[model samples]
Target chain A: MNEPILQVNDLHYYYNDNQAALNGISVSIYPGERIAVIGSNGAGKSTFFLNINGVLSPEHGEIFYHGTKITKKSLPELRKNIGIVFQDADNQIIASSVKAEISFGPMNLKLPREEVSRRVNMAMEYMNITEYGDRPPHYLSGGEKKRVAIADIIAMEPDVIIFDEPTAALDPLNAVMLEEVLEKLSAEQKTLLISTHDVDFAYRWAERVLVFCDGQIIADGTPLSVFQNDEVVKKASLTRPVMLDVYEELVRNGLLADAGVYPRDMREFRELIGK
Target chain B: MSHEHTARSHTGRHHHHKGGHRHDTGGSSIDFYACHSRIRHWNPGFRVGFSIILLLFCILANHPAVSCVIILTAAWITVGMGGLSFRRYFSVLTIPITFILLGSAAVAVDFSRQPIGDFHLYLFWGYLYLTYESLLNTLFLILKVFGAVSAMFIMTLSTPSHELFSVLRKARCPSLIVELMHMIYRYIFILMEVQRNMRISAESRLGFGDFKTSCYSFGQIASNLFIIALKKANAYYDAMEARCYDGTFAFLEEEHQANPKHLIAAGIYLTALMSFWLAIR
Candidate 1:
């Protein structure tokens, strides 16, 4: 069995003036797991990620990071391990320049200056943002700012990085760039938890998908199983990835062969169709 | 994806100290070059100290020659040693010149019922006149102000604002003020971006389509922007908290080894400036 890096046991959270955001949520995240969290708006994905990141203390239940229960004393350690790239880069970016912004997370870890510089350089080079090092982050393009936000987490060299709606406001070209960056990070064996409503993105990128509906995990399985389950799709308010839907339609019409394998992404789907 | 600043947006450019100074374009220009400066990582203490001493010399010296020397030296360091463009250097000086010209007008000509002892007299019911002393003082003040402004601009043109704030903190400046300065520097850009987007959206909706409507729409946008800005403030706080910010300074500052050669050069310049001041006084 894969060792769980993050575990939530009956985790519950409620806003002071609103309904329960995470109602008894429990999930175990294995090391290096590429988990895509899918949910409609107000369906508790953000709340769950926040709890795991130690941004919010759950009203009830427990969250364990690397088998250690996350308490106030352990919150800092948990944060160092679980970095979050917020939906809006403008919000996550607090430093004036790109270098300072990326250096922030490492400095927060209280790392030595030399180590911080090395990590900052590595992350910037990884994200292809070395040119923007001294430029004010506020003046950067949306796509550039997003890269800096990701680099901010990468500089910390976190064990797991959570991206909330990573491609929400990104244009198609920049969106592709972001996915490539995520792919590179994943290849390095860093666990990734991305909460997004982009089904095509989730389908192509994620190995495991967790469907959330009304503050509960309605379905959790391989993308094919969870997304193809009609009841789960309806409950989660998610449409199937376009490629998946089209591939299945072709097979249903006897125009294509399944080959006993579900297509994982667009390239695979095309291969399955023999086109 | 379009990283361009929207045209004619009502950002902090029009609201902050020194009107029409844009946080996006104007401030970023200095910040851009400052970051790219060849000696950007030089100890800010030497830079700040040199600038301040030059500024004081410009004030204390009796002759405009001293101010002229100080101004020339500031321009040389910023444009030569720092590698800032000569065009940009000239352009930055224009800012202080505008105010200095406006202010010097008061001293250049005086109004009096009996016509003050004079260089020139013009009738404005009674008389407007100028004296040799007042004229000299006015010219001297303008030169002094320009010299001081140039000296300070050397620091601003070479050192990024955050680094300057970092230098202040190292000098045992109040943490609250330094932190506030840092946050304000960051949020100004945020607010400016919000302003740009709001402007573009408004313009798309015929907000600035006509003369009267444009005025009305601007007022509405301003009010709406205030409310939204407040909401963004709350969001910013939450975002800060997520990053494990504990109401403390959490950013990294560059640690540069103070250059002994630069310090020695600064000392030489200080002596030259003092000798100039004494000779002129």
Candidate 2:
């Protein structure tokens, strides 16, 4: 579409024992696109994110950012534009206080003091954690720590933000808050790639979906297209999103017209049902 | 969400979690107190400086009066100004006091085949003797240690580790040490939580049904924790790398205004302690 912000070509990664974590993986991630990556455990989702974020080097093939090859010399520059929100907020938080943790990414960029402070304040305010600026991370609840972790990445103002199961340990209220944050980020036109097992969330939130299976991209397309592929669904052992199942059942019963498009969320489902 | 440390009851949070470890068994309580300490808002640099100076005075002066005054002053500052309960202060000190008692025993009590000191007791193997001079020296050493440690406690109890790290940064402490401290401080609680959960799970499974089983379970837990720590270390580095880390460290420091009254009070207290030491000497 718009000169893919990130392009991975036949990427391969191996662990210490020579086991392939990623094998022949290739994808082009467009700027400002909301992409959800779904896979079973040990499916190389985290490794893929690490590779794209330039934390892990691919043993084969190459990755490019804005058409430039990602080399050892370009990693620092690439990292400045692509941030990863790790699954464990505790491990991701490197600073003692919430403000310090948020400022860490910006400070690593070697920005001016004023700009760093300004970004820290803005990120805190955006995450609604401005009051926790002086509080240490150990005392914050799991949800609050998650917010601070997101703020840590947001402060860097990265173009592509990768979240590794951002909602894993989060309670229901926190999940809602996280969704709102994703919506805000999407509105800001930031490219967001989230790896999660929550098929319903992926179905509802993502404009495009990537199903990672055994370190390879088994399916990649709009959520509807990818989810409708029965072979891919069965191969990946993915459960159909509740909304998708209900929508298809209604169409089968002739209670609703086969509108030729699936609803992404509750609002769209309601609109489709004309109720 | 209140997220207010002061509003949260401390009694319910710490005791159940800590395992039987000698290294600050009161770790969480200390953290809670430091985070909520009323005087924490004071400039950490000033607090650190004051504590160091007070500690030096107590050790170098070596006068019983000076040590006593320091112990009193530290207790007063910790309990009175910092809003820590008197019972909590003593409870934290209990471990150190017990350690001191055990340590000074060798000096305070001596055994000889023949009775030597004015105070001697007959034992089947030998004679247990206590010399007044040695007993007095041991007493003075105990008091000096308590005074010095109390001075340190005043600083640590009032300032959180992050604030202390910020002060260290200002003091030009090596970035590597400070950065390591920052990471270690952040992970200690996480690791502790993980270990605590594992222990509870093991207990539920009767992994520690007997002494032998307890030893086996402890070994298993230790090995698992080691593996987890290694994995966590790699993940932490990856997370840091994603943030554009290039071996450079920068931490945001909250600016704290120094209260001149606190400085003046410290000066007056030090001056008063010096005079008391001189008079006693």
Candidate 3:
């Protein structure tokens, strides 16, 4: 709507033997939009994210950031603007110490020492891990490591952040913490694009949903609309969120006169059902 | 949850060791292992200085008594201050002693000329005459190596690896070498774990039926491990790049400080080493 910050056109990718990983996929993301790309395993969701960050190039497609086509020549500049967080926190952390890991991104930009120190402190504070600043990353708890990894990228101040299954290995509590962080990042006007199999996470955090099935986008809309479409959900090999399923079942049984349902959480679902 | 709990326990143990000084306010209840862990308190400059001093001593002095005294002092410091157990101390000396024995055997068999006055038959292998003089010379050689190795280990066991790297960095060690050292240290355990997994997998597959097959399986496992390590390294590098990491390296803090007691002990060790060298000469 307001000068799309990212545009992917006719993207086609493959892993091996020309088996299409992404088939003519097109998506546009604006600044400050929380978009979730949901799909089952081997559905090319991760491949799409990789192509967006220039980590993996599509055989036939064009990716543009701010109307400028991203090329090998401009990848370094593009990457500086788009930070991708890998799923594994262990793989993302490069430095032995927490402080050094956070400072790594700022130092890569070749910022002055004072500015680097300031940004490191700011990023640590943002992640609520100032005390862990002196601790080794390997020694920190998994949640703490994940926070430090996020802080490492946050220090870079990327305009667009990509997370690949951020909550895949996290406990419910840690997953909620991750969602809060993502919400905060989105609030800061950072374009957040996450690829996840967790429908609940997608439904809770994403304003727009992209459902990938057999290396193609079958549905793209608000989370509620996407989940309500049984055909699309079945095709994508995805299940509706529990609350959404319950609401649909209630509507099917003619228990609710109105089918339109929007409940933020389980408690809200109970209240809505009572009404 | 158990894994997380164990990881937390390990972290807690390290933190406890790190914060041991704060609770031990009495100053009399000193734990040498805790003291060794606080080798971070030692000055990087001093570590480098003493390392250079030891290097020079090794090059300039060769007397058996001097080397013996140096070796003995290093062993004492490692055992008393570094908190290395007797078994570990002996284990560290074992390889050098073995090499010395082999060298002495070679000298006895090859050289007919007597280097020292004492000539007693230590071992007789047909025409191979193993003399006591040659044995003593071998022991001296072993002691010299022991002194140098023990000195280096004392520095390492007392000082944290990160501080040791800092000392190396300040000594104008090549950035590439320092980085490689850091990376190797960080990933060696990972590689070892990978190797162990491969071994376990191979064993599980019953690939070790005969000697030849076992060797073949071992080679396959090694090759597979190498490939996996390379893939992991590449993935790790990509992950690092995603986090905006560049070539320059930074550390948490310059933890190594100059403690007066450590310096005094180091000074005493150096003085004793020099006096022994002079006395022997």
Candidate 4:
């Protein structure tokens, strides 16, 4: 197997209140992987992301990017390659104008002015926010702000992008748009890790699933294998995706012949049902 | 809305003192108008410099006639050239005008046990008096204040905060100060929305039914907002760190070419104001 792009081992982080945000987490994130992290609120998904990105140093354990262990001296380099799209777009956006906000990351990289401007324009185009380039981001709708927030990091051209609840405040249409963007990002071979409560979206979008519960990884595998484990799902307080429930019920009641592998999404389900 | 516009939050801790230019505390209305202003494409540096110079001219030429011209011309430039409606122009002026009236009252009205000036009124407690010279002085002060403020309004109501910050950047202002202004400007709206939502929820629960309850709710909201602001600041730092921020900020300024016509118009206006000031004196 190709080397993992990011590796976290025995990571433990504690909040100021002495609450264990991440007890002990060890994970290998390969390049070009679409991973969904699903858990209840306060399951330490955000803390885990922050730790890996070096925003919050873990009390124990180490993180490695491209086989080089992250340390104080290497933090800047690590952060340059790992971008976290925070859940609150308002908190993430630090610039007044959308164009300037997008330029922030690239500028911080000390890139040439022409390179920064090119990345800013490209990121704005990628997020379909070229028209809002000059508009104040505060006036934008929640979803539009989310796109600009994503563009802020996209301009940095990070190798790995972690979105913490990207669809929380997005409308249905905007949520679909986010998914399309995720598809495009994944196609470009950028590693993507999304933490979401939407089990259906995770089932459809992520090839690999990581179940986080109380700061520990309860399960990690393909979405089909992870969701099929009743023990882990029940422990993590996760619900089965609606489509999977229907498929399982049909097979249990002998309405359809059991297939060795369940379909991953609607298109596959339709093919199985001969629609 | 008025309260939110004027209410200072913890984020205002940054010392953002621009020379003679009062930081806009009038909420999003001015910003919205400025963002959509027809003349928003004009160079912000020229706008800032022109307004500051005009403001100084108004102050030094403290004559009422000169002030009147400043007020009328500024109103014309803001409303006519900037495309802001006359109604909005006056609506935004209302806050400063209120301050002017209250301030002028101190200088215009006085109490005495007996009449001692050109204008006097007998009252049960005392005789109110207004000397002719004092009245004229009060009038001069009011007009001077109004003219200075209106000149500032032309700049603020026509240029968005981003442009103003960029102008500051170009004027050799420290990047740290400009970056702080950028962060503060962006978060002000967020904090205001949070405050507005909390107030609405408080009102729905009869939190403002009485003076006592209103005070209590206000305290609760203020404290909660402080806590939220601190949390937000920490999260914002995390976000900035993720972007590889290394104690330096490089803001992207929109390129706007300086138009000589604007300079010529400014020159003609200032020259006319100076001649008017000389003649009126």
Candidate 5:
């Protein structure tokens, strides 16, 4: 409805030495939409993100940013608009220190030093990493590194930020911290795309879900509807979120005879059970 | 426990080089010490300069008495002025001490073709002996090496590697060498962690249940690490490209000007070290 901030049409990509990583997948993303790209390993979710972000150009199809088809000339604009927060913070962080690391993205935009400094300060403050500004980012904890990685992109002020498995290998506390940052980012009205296997996190956090299986997008809809599609979940080799499963079971057993709609999380489930 | 310090990873690549200054034991990193050092804010160029002058002074002076003063004063500055913990300081010296002792032993013991000197202790009919001259030379060499190491200890104990790298970058070291040092310093910690994790993963799978199995697992892990390194290098390049990396890495450096007080301290240290050297010579 908001002119599809980003769109991909029959997008196809392949590894140089391997088969197609993304095949015949298409989707449109809108502003303020929290999208969770869910699938098994090698499900083309990462390839899809890279394609839309212009890191990997599609061979068979095309990606559009703000209604303009992405190409070699439009790539820089597309990349600046659609930032990808890589899964491994160590890989994403190019600068040695946190301050320099955050400044990198903004400086690449070739903004004036004062504006770059402004953005750097704002990003560090936003990510709550001001204390570590002088510290080396490689020395930051997994969660701290993740924050700095996100901060690296946020400093650029991208409209659409994509995270590739933001919580993988992070400890429980760090994972929760990541969720809070995601919540804050979402609240700020920036479009967020995250590719992860954590169905529970997707169920609770994402409004929209896109399921990829074997390089093809099998389902795309609200998390409740898409995850509730047992066939899609089965094909994707993903278990349906427990909350959705329980809600469906209740409706099937006629125990939720008075139920109005499916619940997305524990709090919503409790409210539904109470009703 | 960073002693209420933030739970920093300290496993970063720079930490490997910073910890190199003080630890060959895989012990706790000395970066905490370096970051909190009294001279932490001192210009790295100044610290390096002071340490170099002190080290050369010791080596060129070559007097046991001057070496003693250099060693004692460096230890004092590192511990007192630099705030390096006694525990870490002692641990860091172990490697240097080992090498110096081995070298000194060679100097102390001799196999002569002629009759032994008057000060020599006869062994195997004077063919093998320890002479006073050799012993003196050994002691002097020991002191010289120890004093030189202690000078380095002070510098490494005070300045973190990244800052030192910056100083080197500013001094117009070949960019490629500096970058190589920076990258190698980082990947060492990352690779070491990867190696450690793979070992743990292997153990978890009982891949190392027996000596035969352990050897097999070691072989597998080494090969797997190589593959992982290749994959990681590829991923890192893509990430860098995603961030619009040009050829050079630009940083938002906080300026650190040289301190005159620090300069005065350097002057005083030179005066003290050389005064002892002059008095001894």
Candidate 6:
């Protein structure tokens, strides 16, 4: 296939005096891949994202983005290629107005004023938040704020978008909206990497799953395969999606012949039951 | 309710000093300080106009009668229309009212000249004079102070802090100041929690042994708290950078349009204020 867009080789990281947070992890992500990194708290999921984005330097590893080593000298270019959406919308939001916030990233790249305005308009329209253009960040609802946060990065038009727990505090409806946004981004040929504990979100949105445990990549494969392994799930402190759990329970009770009968959506679930 | 209002009046003044302008009472256990969240439903332009009027009234009206009228009207509006109870209103008013009383007393004692023939009471080396002009001036000053204060109270009570920020943004307030206000608003609670935790830890360790020991321990605690706060601030900044923030806040909602009704009301208020000023002149 084509060269990987991002390659991590034997990455190691730590905090507070050599207490390893990421231990010799290696992963390569191809272009336009929707990947989910699942792990419990303190499992180094956040640290890995930090390293990839060049926010934190790794202890003994090389990270390559577009064939260039991710170093301080190359950070500006690396950051331009990869956009990160933080978990806390409050902390990430820095502009006084929505329009300004969305325009900030592109403006920082020294894009022409007209280009910056066009990108801001397009990003806001894509996110369905055109009306909030003049409103202050503080007045937004939690979901709206999250959308703004995403829109901020989207305006930059990065090659890869990394979200750290995008759905952590979002309600079900907002979470679904965010998932749709992610799907759209992936469809647009932008690689999407999300670090989350949201099993259902990962199951539905991720094409490939990377399971992290105690700062190590314990499992990496398709979501279905990674999630099916009981040991990996247990080690990562994650639960299977509700449907998977139900299907497994049904098979255990001899209600179904096999556990491989997975439904992709609610409609499929209903169809599988002939409802 | 009156007692609560009185308490609020007192605490409100103290809060002004404490830099607690953005009263976030949703998760706060302090019932008296609970800000009304319903104000979010009001038309943004109307709220902005109302805020401007309140600010003007506070700055311009100095007479006690006008101030009394302002305070009473605000109280009535908050209680009758805003669905706020007298208790809630009083809780906000208590501290300010105390300050007004204290201020009036001080003015009377320090500045008012005693009428030669009319002495109210004689004390050791002092005579208490009761002058009609002095009393009227003192009362008027007290009323004006309360009036101005109550105007601010009504604005805060009727408008949520977030909405205020939105209005400020729309008004084209300095972006840096607005962002700083927002950050300070959010971090104040975090700092309070940190301070509270630090105090508890210090207490648990029995750091308050004696005068000198307590002072030294307090200094150490303060230093440690500052360092911790700085570290958290740095982490928060890193988190922001990781999220691709390049400075600028975005909102989810559209620009709030000014309502015709609010516009009309604002016009009327402005006309009335000008007329009142003319009458005073």
Best by lDDT: 2
> Which candidate do you rate higher for TM-score, 2 or 5?
2
Writing each residue's lDDT as its tens digit, candidate 3 over B153-211 gives 55655554455666788879998888787676556535654665577678899888899
**What DockQ does each listed candidate score?**
0.53, 0.54, 0.38, 0.55, 0.39, 0.18
Ranking by DockQ: 4, 2, 1, 5, 3, 6
lDDT by residue (A1-275, candidate 3, tens digit) is 68899999999998886699999999888999999989889898878877787777789999999999998887777778999888877667766567877877788887888888888889999989998775545456677878888898898899999888888778888888888899799889999989998897788778999999989999999999999899999988898887677766777889876646577577788788787
Best by TM-score: 2
TM-score of each: 0.89, 0.92, 0.79, 0.91, 0.87, 0.66
Regions of candidate 4 where Cα sits further than 4 Å from its true position: A16-19, B1-25, B110-114, B123-126, B279-281
lDDT of 1 by residue, B98-145 (tens): 889999998688877885676557676887888888888899888889
Which of 1 and 2 is the better model by DockQ?
A: 2
Estimate candidate 1's alpha-carbon lDDT, on a 0 to 1 scale: 0.81
lDDT of 5 by residue, B128-168 (tens): 66777888889889999999999987788788667777888
User: Which of the predicted structures, 2 or 4, would earn the higher DockQ when compared with the native?
Assistant: 4
The top-ranked prediction according to DockQ is 4
lDDT of 6 by residue, A155-201 (tens): 88999999999988888898889888987987899999999887887
Best first by lDDT, ranked: 2, 4, 1, 5, 6, 3
What is the per-residue lDDT of model 6 for residues B111-227, given as tens digits with 9 covering 90 to 100?
A: 223435243565656566656777777877777777777767656666644556767877899978877876776565456556655766787888777888789878987898889
lDDT of 2 at B239: 87
DockQ of 3: 0.38
Residue A268 lDDT in candidate 5: 86
Candidate 6, residue A199: lDDT:
89
The CA lDDT at A33 in model 6 is 95
Clashing pairs in 3: B40-B256, B41-B257
Show the lowest summed lDDT stretch of 10 residues, model 6 chain B.
Answer: B25-34
Report, for every candidate in turn, its global Cα lDDT versus the true structure.
Answer: 0.81, 0.88, 0.73, 0.88, 0.80, 0.74
Q: List residue ranges in candidate 3 displaced over 4 A.
A: A14-17, A71-73, A96-98, A124-145, A250-259, A270-275, B1-36, B63-126, B158-169, B201-217, B240-272
Location of the lowest summed lDDT over 10 successive residues in candidate 5 chain B:
B1-10
Question: How far off is residue A68 in model 5, in Å?
Answer: 3.0
Candidate 2, superposed: residue stretches over 4 Å from native: A16-19, A271-274, B1-24, B112-118, B131-137
